[model samples]
Target: MPARFMQMQEVADELSVSVSQVYHMVRSGELPAIKVGGRGQWRIERARLEDYIERKYTETADWVRENPLIGREDEIDPSD
Candidate 1:
Protein backbone atom coordinates (compact mmCIF):
# COMPACT_ATOMS: atom_id res chain seq x y z
CA MET A 1 0.00 0.00 0.00
CA PRO A 2 1.06 3.56 -0.54
CA ALA A 3 2.12 5.77 2.33
CA ARG A 4 -0.72 7.58 4.08
CA PHE A 5 1.57 10.08 5.79
CA MET A 6 5.10 11.47 5.48
CA GLN A 7 7.62 13.03 7.82
CA MET A 8 8.80 16.62 7.52
CA GLN A 9 12.09 15.52 5.98
CA GLU A 10 10.27 13.41 3.43
CA VAL A 11 8.11 16.38 2.44
CA ALA A 12 11.18 18.58 2.19
CA ASP A 13 12.93 16.11 -0.11
CA GLU A 14 9.84 15.73 -2.27
CA LEU A 15 9.60 19.53 -2.72
CA SER A 16 13.41 20.01 -3.10
CA VAL A 17 13.43 22.57 -0.30
CA SER A 18 15.17 22.79 3.07
CA VAL A 19 13.70 20.94 6.05
CA SER A 20 13.46 24.22 7.90
CA GLN A 21 11.40 25.65 5.07
CA VAL A 22 9.00 22.75 5.40
CA TYR A 23 8.74 23.40 9.12
CA HIS A 24 7.90 27.03 8.45
CA MET A 25 5.32 26.05 5.87
CA VAL A 26 3.58 23.84 8.37
CA ARG A 27 3.76 26.52 11.02
CA SER A 28 2.31 29.14 8.65
CA GLY A 29 -0.75 26.95 7.76
CA GLU A 30 0.33 26.86 4.11
CA LEU A 31 0.55 23.08 4.25
CA PRO A 32 -1.72 20.71 6.12
CA ALA A 33 -0.21 18.39 8.73
CA ILE A 34 -0.62 16.91 12.16
CA LYS A 35 1.64 16.79 15.16
CA VAL A 36 2.06 13.22 16.35
CA GLY A 37 4.42 11.19 18.56
CA GLY A 38 5.41 12.05 22.12
CA ARG A 39 7.96 14.63 21.05
CA GLY A 40 5.49 16.63 18.92
CA GLN A 41 6.65 15.40 15.56
CA TRP A 42 4.92 16.47 12.33
CA ARG A 43 3.19 14.14 9.88
CA ILE A 44 1.84 15.37 6.57
CA GLU A 45 -0.73 13.41 4.69
CA ARG A 46 0.41 12.50 1.19
CA ALA A 47 -2.84 13.76 -0.34
CA ARG A 48 -2.52 17.06 1.46
CA LEU A 49 0.96 17.55 0.07
CA GLU A 50 -0.36 16.98 -3.42
CA ASP A 51 -3.15 19.45 -2.82
CA TYR A 52 -0.69 22.08 -1.65
CA ILE A 53 1.34 21.69 -4.82
CA GLU A 54 -1.76 22.01 -6.97
CA ARG A 55 -2.83 25.13 -5.12
CA LYS A 56 0.57 26.71 -5.64
CA TYR A 57 0.35 25.98 -9.34
CA THR A 58 -3.00 27.70 -9.55
CA GLU A 59 -1.70 30.70 -7.64
CA THR A 60 1.30 31.02 -9.91
CA ALA A 61 -0.87 30.85 -13.01
CA ASP A 62 -3.10 33.56 -11.67
CA TRP A 63 -0.12 35.78 -10.91
CA VAL A 64 1.30 35.29 -14.37
CA ARG A 65 -2.04 36.19 -15.89
CA GLU A 66 -2.13 39.37 -13.84
CA ASN A 67 1.49 40.44 -14.30
CA PRO A 68 2.76 39.68 -17.80
CA LEU A 69 6.24 40.67 -18.91
CA ILE A 70 6.81 43.09 -21.77
CA GLY A 71 9.94 43.17 -23.91
CA ARG A 72 11.27 45.30 -26.74
CA GLU A 73 12.90 43.25 -29.49
CA ASP A 74 14.81 46.26 -30.85
CA GLU A 75 16.48 46.93 -27.52
CA ILE A 76 18.76 43.89 -27.90
CA ASP A 77 22.20 44.03 -29.53
CA PRO A 78 23.41 41.25 -31.84
CA SER A 79 26.93 41.41 -30.38
CA ASP A 80 27.65 41.58 -26.68
Candidate 2:
Protein backbone atom coordinates (compact mmCIF):
# COMPACT_ATOMS: atom_id res chain seq x y z
CA MET A 1 0.00 0.00 0.00
CA PRO A 2 1.11 3.55 -0.74
CA ALA A 3 0.73 6.63 1.41
CA ARG A 4 -2.13 8.99 0.74
CA PHE A 5 0.10 11.99 1.32
CA MET A 6 3.84 12.59 1.17
CA GLN A 7 6.21 14.87 3.00
CA MET A 8 8.19 17.62 1.22
CA GLN A 9 11.34 15.49 1.17
CA GLU A 10 9.47 12.49 -0.22
CA VAL A 11 7.95 14.60 -2.94
CA ALA A 12 11.35 16.06 -3.79
CA ASP A 13 12.91 12.60 -3.92
CA GLU A 14 10.16 11.31 -6.23
CA LEU A 15 10.57 14.30 -8.54
CA SER A 16 14.35 14.16 -8.50
CA VAL A 17 14.55 17.79 -7.38
CA SER A 18 15.75 19.64 -4.32
CA VAL A 19 13.55 19.98 -1.24
CA SER A 20 13.81 23.78 -1.53
CA GLN A 21 12.42 23.58 -5.05
CA VAL A 22 9.40 21.70 -3.76
CA TYR A 23 8.96 24.35 -1.07
CA HIS A 24 9.11 27.07 -3.71
CA MET A 25 6.51 25.30 -5.82
CA VAL A 26 4.19 25.01 -2.86
CA ARG A 27 4.81 28.64 -1.87
CA SER A 28 4.32 29.91 -5.43
CA GLY A 29 1.13 27.87 -5.90
CA GLU A 30 2.65 25.87 -8.71
CA LEU A 31 2.17 22.65 -6.77
CA PRO A 32 -0.74 22.11 -4.41
CA ALA A 33 0.11 21.14 -0.80
CA ILE A 34 -1.22 21.30 2.70
CA LYS A 35 0.31 22.26 6.04
CA VAL A 36 -0.32 19.88 8.91
CA GLY A 37 0.72 19.01 12.45
CA GLY A 38 1.92 21.40 15.18
CA ARG A 39 5.12 22.17 13.30
CA GLY A 40 3.14 23.07 10.16
CA GLN A 41 4.98 20.63 7.97
CA TRP A 42 3.92 20.50 4.32
CA ARG A 43 2.41 17.42 2.77
CA ILE A 44 1.43 16.79 -0.84
CA GLU A 45 -1.25 14.34 -1.81
CA ARG A 46 -0.12 11.53 -4.11
CA ALA A 47 -2.89 12.34 -6.56
CA ARG A 48 -1.89 16.00 -6.60
CA LEU A 49 1.73 15.12 -7.32
CA GLU A 50 0.63 12.87 -10.19
CA ASP A 51 -1.55 15.67 -11.52
CA TYR A 52 1.38 18.08 -11.40
CA ILE A 53 3.53 15.66 -13.39
CA GLU A 54 0.80 15.23 -16.04
CA ARG A 55 0.33 18.98 -16.26
CA LYS A 56 4.03 19.53 -16.75
CA TYR A 57 4.07 16.95 -19.53
CA THR A 58 1.23 18.73 -21.28
CA GLU A 59 2.86 22.11 -20.85
CA THR A 60 6.17 20.83 -22.18
CA ALA A 61 4.44 19.28 -25.20
CA ASP A 62 2.67 22.55 -25.92
CA TRP A 63 5.93 24.46 -25.64
CA VAL A 64 7.65 22.04 -27.99
CA ARG A 65 4.84 22.35 -30.51
CA GLU A 66 5.03 26.13 -30.38
CA ASN A 67 8.81 26.21 -30.57
CA PRO A 68 9.75 23.63 -33.17
CA LEU A 69 13.52 23.14 -33.56
CA ILE A 70 13.29 21.91 -37.13
CA GLY A 71 15.32 24.51 -38.98
CA ARG A 72 16.34 26.81 -36.17
CA GLU A 73 18.60 24.43 -34.29
CA ASP A 74 21.57 26.57 -35.25
CA GLU A 75 19.99 29.63 -33.65
CA ILE A 76 20.43 28.07 -30.21
CA ASP A 77 23.66 29.01 -28.50
CA PRO A 78 25.26 26.03 -26.74
CA SER A 79 27.50 28.28 -24.70
CA ASP A 80 24.63 29.73 -22.77
Candidate 3:
Protein backbone atom coordinates (compact mmCIF):
# COMPACT_ATOMS: atom_id res chain seq x y z
CA MET A 1 0.00 0.00 0.00
CA PRO A 2 1.09 3.54 -0.69
CA ALA A 3 1.95 5.84 2.16
CA ARG A 4 -0.84 7.88 3.72
CA PHE A 5 1.58 10.69 4.38
CA MET A 6 4.40 11.98 2.22
CA GLN A 7 7.56 13.90 3.00
CA MET A 8 8.22 17.35 1.51
CA GLN A 9 10.60 15.95 -1.07
CA GLU A 10 8.09 13.29 -2.06
CA VAL A 11 5.39 15.89 -2.50
CA ALA A 12 7.76 17.94 -4.65
CA ASP A 13 8.55 14.94 -6.83
CA GLU A 14 4.87 14.08 -7.14
CA LEU A 15 4.10 17.60 -8.30
CA SER A 16 7.18 17.78 -10.51
CA VAL A 17 8.27 20.94 -8.69
CA SER A 18 11.28 21.85 -6.59
CA VAL A 19 11.32 21.02 -2.89
CA SER A 20 11.62 24.72 -2.10
CA GLN A 21 8.50 25.35 -4.16
CA VAL A 22 6.63 22.78 -2.12
CA TYR A 23 7.85 24.47 1.05
CA HIS A 24 6.59 27.77 -0.30
CA MET A 25 3.18 26.28 -0.99
CA VAL A 26 3.00 24.90 2.52
CA ARG A 27 4.13 28.16 4.05
CA SER A 28 1.71 30.12 1.89
CA GLY A 29 -1.16 27.79 2.85
CA GLU A 30 -1.84 26.84 -0.73
CA LEU A 31 -0.98 23.27 0.14
CA PRO A 32 -1.80 21.62 3.44
CA ALA A 33 1.10 20.22 5.44
CA ILE A 34 2.16 19.70 9.02
CA LYS A 35 5.55 19.65 10.72
CA VAL A 36 6.40 16.37 12.43
CA GLY A 37 9.23 14.94 14.47
CA GLY A 38 11.47 16.91 16.82
CA ARG A 39 13.48 17.92 13.75
CA GLY A 40 10.49 19.85 12.39
CA GLN A 41 9.98 18.10 9.07
CA TRP A 42 6.91 18.77 6.96
CA ARG A 43 4.49 16.01 6.06
CA ILE A 44 1.56 16.16 3.64
CA GLU A 45 -1.39 13.83 3.66
CA ARG A 46 -2.14 12.15 0.33
CA ALA A 47 -5.78 13.16 0.53
CA ARG A 48 -4.84 16.80 0.91
CA LEU A 49 -2.52 16.61 -2.05
CA GLU A 50 -5.32 15.14 -4.13
CA ASP A 51 -7.63 17.88 -2.95
CA TYR A 52 -5.09 20.50 -3.96
CA ILE A 53 -4.80 19.00 -7.44
CA GLU A 54 -8.60 18.96 -7.82
CA ARG A 55 -8.80 22.54 -6.67
CA LYS A 56 -6.16 23.54 -9.23
CA TYR A 57 -8.22 21.88 -11.98
CA THR A 58 -11.30 23.76 -10.86
CA GLU A 59 -9.38 27.04 -10.76
CA THR A 60 -7.99 26.45 -14.25
CA ALA A 61 -11.45 25.69 -15.57
CA ASP A 62 -12.80 28.90 -14.09
CA TRP A 63 -9.94 30.91 -15.58
CA VAL A 64 -10.55 29.40 -19.01
CA ARG A 65 -14.21 30.29 -18.80
CA GLU A 66 -13.54 33.86 -17.71
CA ASN A 67 -10.72 34.44 -20.19
CA PRO A 68 -11.46 32.71 -23.43
CA LEU A 69 -8.70 32.84 -26.04
CA ILE A 70 -9.71 34.43 -29.37
CA GLY A 71 -10.03 31.93 -32.21
CA ARG A 72 -8.85 29.10 -30.01
CA GLU A 73 -11.81 26.88 -30.80
CA ASP A 74 -11.81 27.77 -34.50
CA GLU A 75 -8.10 27.22 -35.05
CA ILE A 76 -7.42 24.87 -37.95
CA ASP A 77 -5.23 21.84 -37.53
CA PRO A 78 -1.88 22.48 -39.18
CA SER A 79 -1.52 18.72 -39.64
CA ASP A 80 -4.56 18.78 -41.93
Candidate 4:
Protein backbone atom coordinates (compact mmCIF):
# COMPACT_ATOMS: atom_id res chain seq x y z
CA MET A 1 0.00 0.00 0.00
CA PRO A 2 1.14 3.54 -0.61
CA ALA A 3 2.05 5.74 2.30
CA ARG A 4 -0.64 8.05 3.65
CA PHE A 5 1.96 10.64 4.61
CA MET A 6 5.32 11.55 3.09
CA GLN A 7 8.47 13.27 4.32
CA MET A 8 9.54 16.62 2.88
CA GLN A 9 12.28 14.96 0.84
CA GLU A 10 9.81 12.47 -0.59
CA VAL A 11 7.47 15.31 -1.50
CA ALA A 12 10.33 17.16 -3.24
CA ASP A 13 11.31 14.02 -5.15
CA GLU A 14 7.71 13.45 -6.23
CA LEU A 15 7.45 17.07 -7.41
CA SER A 16 10.88 16.88 -9.14
CA VAL A 17 12.07 19.89 -7.14
CA SER A 18 14.73 20.52 -4.50
CA VAL A 19 14.13 19.70 -0.86
CA SER A 20 14.69 23.36 0.00
CA GLN A 21 11.93 24.30 -2.40
CA VAL A 22 9.58 21.93 -0.63
CA TYR A 23 10.59 23.47 2.69
CA HIS A 24 9.88 26.92 1.34
CA MET A 25 6.45 25.84 0.11
CA VAL A 26 5.60 24.41 3.48
CA ARG A 27 6.93 27.41 5.39
CA SER A 28 5.07 29.81 3.15
CA GLY A 29 1.83 27.80 3.58
CA GLU A 30 1.61 27.21 -0.16
CA LEU A 31 1.67 23.49 0.57
CA PRO A 32 -0.10 21.79 3.43
CA ALA A 33 2.18 19.96 5.90
CA ILE A 34 2.43 19.06 9.51
CA LYS A 35 5.20 18.97 12.10
CA VAL A 36 5.80 15.55 13.53
CA GLY A 37 7.97 13.84 16.12
CA GLY A 38 10.12 15.54 18.74
CA ARG A 39 12.59 16.75 16.12
CA GLY A 40 9.81 18.71 14.36
CA GLN A 41 10.21 16.98 11.03
CA TRP A 42 7.68 17.96 8.37
CA ARG A 43 5.32 15.49 6.73
CA ILE A 44 2.71 16.16 4.09
CA GLU A 45 -0.42 14.12 3.67
CA ARG A 46 -0.58 12.18 0.42
CA ALA A 47 -4.05 13.50 -0.34
CA ARG A 48 -2.92 17.07 0.18
CA LEU A 49 0.04 16.60 -2.15
CA GLU A 50 -2.23 15.15 -4.81
CA ASP A 51 -4.58 18.07 -4.37
CA TYR A 52 -1.70 20.52 -4.75
CA ILE A 53 -0.61 18.84 -7.99
CA GLU A 54 -4.15 19.03 -9.36
CA ARG A 55 -4.40 22.69 -8.44
CA LYS A 56 -1.10 23.40 -10.19
CA TYR A 57 -2.39 21.68 -13.32
CA THR A 58 -5.50 23.84 -13.30
CA GLU A 59 -3.45 27.00 -12.70
CA THR A 60 -1.05 26.12 -15.52
CA ALA A 61 -3.95 25.50 -17.89
CA ASP A 62 -5.46 28.87 -17.00
CA TRP A 63 -2.10 30.57 -17.50
CA VAL A 64 -1.67 28.96 -20.90
CA ARG A 65 -5.12 30.06 -21.98
CA GLU A 66 -4.56 33.60 -20.75
CA ASN A 67 -1.05 33.90 -22.22
CA PRO A 68 -1.25 32.47 -25.71
CA LEU A 69 2.09 32.20 -27.52
CA ILE A 70 0.57 32.58 -31.00
CA GLY A 71 3.07 34.54 -33.17
CA ARG A 72 5.18 35.56 -30.15
CA GLU A 73 6.89 32.16 -29.90
CA ASP A 74 9.71 33.39 -32.14
CA GLU A 75 10.29 36.36 -29.85
CA ILE A 76 11.02 34.19 -26.82
CA ASP A 77 14.69 34.03 -25.79
CA PRO A 78 16.08 30.52 -25.99
CA SER A 79 18.72 31.20 -23.33
CA ASP A 80 17.30 32.93 -20.30
Candidate 5:
Protein backbone atom coordinates (compact mmCIF):
# COMPACT_ATOMS: atom_id res chain seq x y z
CA MET A 1 0.00 0.00 0.00
CA PRO A 2 1.13 3.57 -0.68
CA ALA A 3 2.35 5.48 2.36
CA ARG A 4 0.11 8.14 3.84
CA PHE A 5 1.65 11.56 4.56
CA MET A 6 0.90 14.42 6.88
CA GLN A 7 1.64 18.13 6.51
CA MET A 8 3.93 20.15 8.80
CA GLN A 9 0.94 21.62 10.63
CA GLU A 10 -0.55 18.19 11.13
CA VAL A 11 2.76 16.82 12.37
CA ALA A 12 3.20 19.74 14.76
CA ASP A 13 -0.36 19.45 16.03
CA GLU A 14 0.00 15.69 16.53
CA LEU A 15 3.31 16.12 18.33
CA SER A 16 2.03 19.06 20.36
CA VAL A 17 4.78 21.36 19.13
CA SER A 18 5.02 24.49 17.02
CA VAL A 19 5.19 24.51 13.24
CA SER A 20 8.76 25.84 13.54
CA GLN A 21 9.61 22.76 15.58
CA VAL A 22 8.35 20.53 12.79
CA TYR A 23 10.41 22.54 10.31
CA HIS A 24 13.43 22.13 12.53
CA MET A 25 12.78 18.41 12.81
CA VAL A 26 12.79 18.17 9.02
CA ARG A 27 15.91 20.36 8.81
CA SER A 28 17.71 18.20 11.36
CA GLY A 29 16.63 14.99 9.62
CA GLU A 30 15.32 13.70 12.91
CA LEU A 31 11.89 13.39 11.40
CA PRO A 32 11.70 11.66 8.04
CA ALA A 33 9.68 13.83 5.66
CA ILE A 34 9.61 14.96 2.06
CA LYS A 35 8.87 18.18 0.20
CA VAL A 36 6.38 17.46 -2.50
CA GLY A 37 5.91 19.32 -5.78
CA GLY A 38 7.28 22.83 -6.48
CA ARG A 39 5.40 24.38 -3.58
CA GLY A 40 7.56 22.35 -1.12
CA GLN A 41 4.98 21.22 1.33
CA TRP A 42 6.60 19.36 4.23
CA ARG A 43 4.93 15.96 4.19
CA ILE A 44 5.87 13.11 6.51
CA GLU A 45 5.02 9.50 5.91
CA ARG A 46 3.54 7.63 8.85
CA ALA A 47 5.89 4.70 8.29
CA ARG A 48 8.84 7.02 7.79
CA LEU A 49 8.08 8.84 11.03
CA GLU A 50 7.82 5.55 12.88
CA ASP A 51 11.04 4.39 11.31
CA TYR A 52 12.79 7.59 12.32
CA ILE A 53 11.62 7.20 15.90
CA GLU A 54 12.82 3.62 15.97
CA ARG A 55 16.17 4.51 14.45
CA LYS A 56 16.69 7.29 16.97
CA TYR A 57 15.85 5.07 19.90
CA THR A 58 18.16 2.34 18.61
CA GLU A 59 20.98 4.82 17.97
CA THR A 60 20.75 6.21 21.49
CA ALA A 61 20.97 2.71 22.94
CA ASP A 62 24.75 2.89 22.61
CA TRP A 63 25.06 5.99 24.79
CA VAL A 64 24.95 4.01 28.01
CA ARG A 65 27.36 1.42 26.71
CA GLU A 66 30.02 3.08 28.80
CA ASN A 67 28.61 5.83 30.97
CA PRO A 68 25.22 7.41 30.47
CA LEU A 69 26.43 10.72 31.91
CA ILE A 70 29.42 10.87 29.60
CA GLY A 71 28.47 12.78 26.43
CA ARG A 72 31.04 14.06 23.97
CA GLU A 73 34.18 14.17 26.08
CA ASP A 74 35.66 16.91 23.90
CA GLU A 75 32.65 19.20 23.69
CA ILE A 76 31.84 21.65 26.45
CA ASP A 77 28.86 20.71 28.58
CA PRO A 78 25.72 22.71 27.92
CA SER A 79 24.78 22.83 31.62
CA ASP A 80 28.16 24.26 32.50
Candidate 6:
Protein backbone atom coordinates (compact mmCIF):
# COMPACT_ATOMS: atom_id res chain seq x y z
CA MET A 1 0.00 0.00 0.00
CA PRO A 2 1.04 3.63 -0.45
CA ALA A 3 2.05 5.93 2.38
CA ARG A 4 -1.36 7.58 2.44
CA PHE A 5 -1.31 8.35 6.10
CA MET A 6 -1.14 11.36 8.45
CA GLN A 7 -0.11 11.55 12.05
CA MET A 8 -2.66 12.39 14.72
CA GLN A 9 -0.87 15.61 15.64
CA GLU A 10 -0.83 16.79 12.05
CA VAL A 11 -4.50 16.05 11.63
CA ALA A 12 -5.30 17.74 14.92
CA ASP A 13 -3.41 20.87 13.90
CA GLU A 14 -5.12 20.91 10.53
CA LEU A 15 -8.54 20.62 12.16
CA SER A 16 -7.68 23.07 14.95
CA VAL A 17 -8.64 20.49 17.54
CA SER A 18 -6.89 18.90 20.46
CA VAL A 19 -4.98 15.67 20.18
CA SER A 20 -7.50 14.10 22.51
CA GLN A 21 -10.23 15.09 20.08
CA VAL A 22 -8.37 13.44 17.28
CA TYR A 23 -7.95 10.38 19.45
CA HIS A 24 -11.65 10.42 20.09
CA MET A 25 -12.30 10.61 16.37
CA VAL A 26 -10.09 7.60 15.83
CA ARG A 27 -11.72 5.79 18.68
CA SER A 28 -15.19 6.56 17.37
CA GLY A 29 -14.22 5.68 13.83
CA GLU A 30 -15.33 9.09 12.55
CA LEU A 31 -12.01 9.48 10.82
CA PRO A 32 -10.56 6.75 8.65
CA ALA A 33 -7.56 5.60 10.61
CA ILE A 34 -5.59 2.48 11.37
CA LYS A 35 -3.55 1.28 14.30
CA VAL A 36 -0.62 -0.69 13.09
CA GLY A 37 2.14 -2.93 14.47
CA GLY A 38 0.47 -3.35 17.82
CA ARG A 39 1.07 0.27 18.53
CA GLY A 40 -1.49 2.81 19.69
CA GLN A 41 -0.35 5.14 16.93
CA TRP A 42 -3.13 6.34 14.65
CA ARG A 43 -2.89 7.39 11.03
CA ILE A 44 -5.65 8.84 8.93
CA GLU A 45 -6.09 8.95 5.19
CA ARG A 46 -5.84 12.43 3.67
CA ALA A 47 -8.83 11.79 1.44
CA ARG A 48 -10.93 10.76 4.41
CA LEU A 49 -9.95 13.98 6.17
CA GLU A 50 -11.06 15.96 3.13
CA ASP A 51 -14.35 14.11 3.10
CA TYR A 52 -14.92 14.93 6.75
CA ILE A 53 -14.25 18.60 6.06
CA GLU A 54 -16.72 18.57 3.17
CA ARG A 55 -19.35 16.93 5.34
CA LYS A 56 -18.87 19.55 8.05
CA TYR A 57 -19.23 22.33 5.47
CA THR A 58 -22.45 20.83 4.14
CA GLU A 59 -23.86 20.44 7.62
CA THR A 60 -22.91 23.99 8.55
CA ALA A 61 -24.55 25.31 5.37
CA ASP A 62 -27.72 23.41 6.14
CA TRP A 63 -27.74 24.77 9.67
CA VAL A 64 -27.26 28.32 8.37
CA ARG A 65 -30.20 27.88 5.99
CA GLU A 66 -32.34 26.58 8.79
CA ASN A 67 -31.34 29.41 11.09
CA PRO A 68 -30.82 32.48 9.00
CA LEU A 69 -28.65 35.34 10.19
CA ILE A 70 -30.17 37.60 12.79
CA GLY A 71 -31.10 40.90 11.14
CA ARG A 72 -34.03 43.12 10.31
CA GLU A 73 -35.77 44.39 7.19
CA ASP A 74 -34.50 47.88 7.99
CA GLU A 75 -30.98 46.55 7.56
CA ILE A 76 -31.61 46.73 3.82
CA ASP A 77 -33.43 50.02 3.31
CA PRO A 78 -33.54 52.03 0.13
CA SER A 79 -34.64 55.44 1.52
CA ASP A 80 -31.87 55.78 4.08
Best by TM-score: 4
Q: TM-score for each prediction?
A: 0.86, 0.88, 0.86, 0.89, 0.60, 0.76
lDDT of 1 by residue, 1-80 (tens): 97999999999999999999999999999998999989999999999999999999999999978876567566668784
- Candidate 4: what lDDT? 0.95
Give the per-residue lDDT of model 2 (tens digit) for 6-80.
999999999989999999999999999999999999999999999999999999999989988998887999985
TM-score of 1: 0.86
lDDT per residue as tens, model 5, 1-80: 75499888877887778999989989997787888999887899988877876786877786656555565677757785
The 10-residue segment of model 2 with minimum total lDDT is 71-80
Candidate 4 Cα errors over 4 Å, as ranges: 75-80
Error of 4 at 44 (Å): 0.5
* Candidate 3 segments exceeding 4 Å error: 72-80
Q: Model 5, residue 51: displacement in angstroms?
A: 2.1
Name the runs in model 6 displaced over 4 angstroms. Answer: 1-3, 72-80
lDDT of 6 by residue, 1-80 (tens): 64578899999999989999999988888777887666677789888899989988999899979987477555756863
RMSD (Å) of each candidate, 1 decimal: 5.2, 2.8, 4.1, 2.3, 6.2, 6.9
Candidates' C-alpha lDDT: 0.94, 0.96, 0.94, 0.95, 0.80, 0.85
Per-residue lDDT of model 4, residues 1-80, tens digit only = 89999999999899989999999999999999999999999999999999999999999999989999999988999885
Residue 9 error, candidate 6, Å: 0.3
> Is candidate 3 or 5 superior in TM-score?
3
Instruction: Give the candidate number with the greatest lDDT.
Output: 2
Better of 1 and 6 by lDDT: 1
How much does candidate 5 score in TM-score? 0.60
Pitting candidate 2 against candidate 6, the one with the higher TM-score is 2
Per-candidate clashes come to 0, 0, 0, 0, 0, 0
Q: Is candidate 1 or candidate 2 better by TM-score?
A: 2
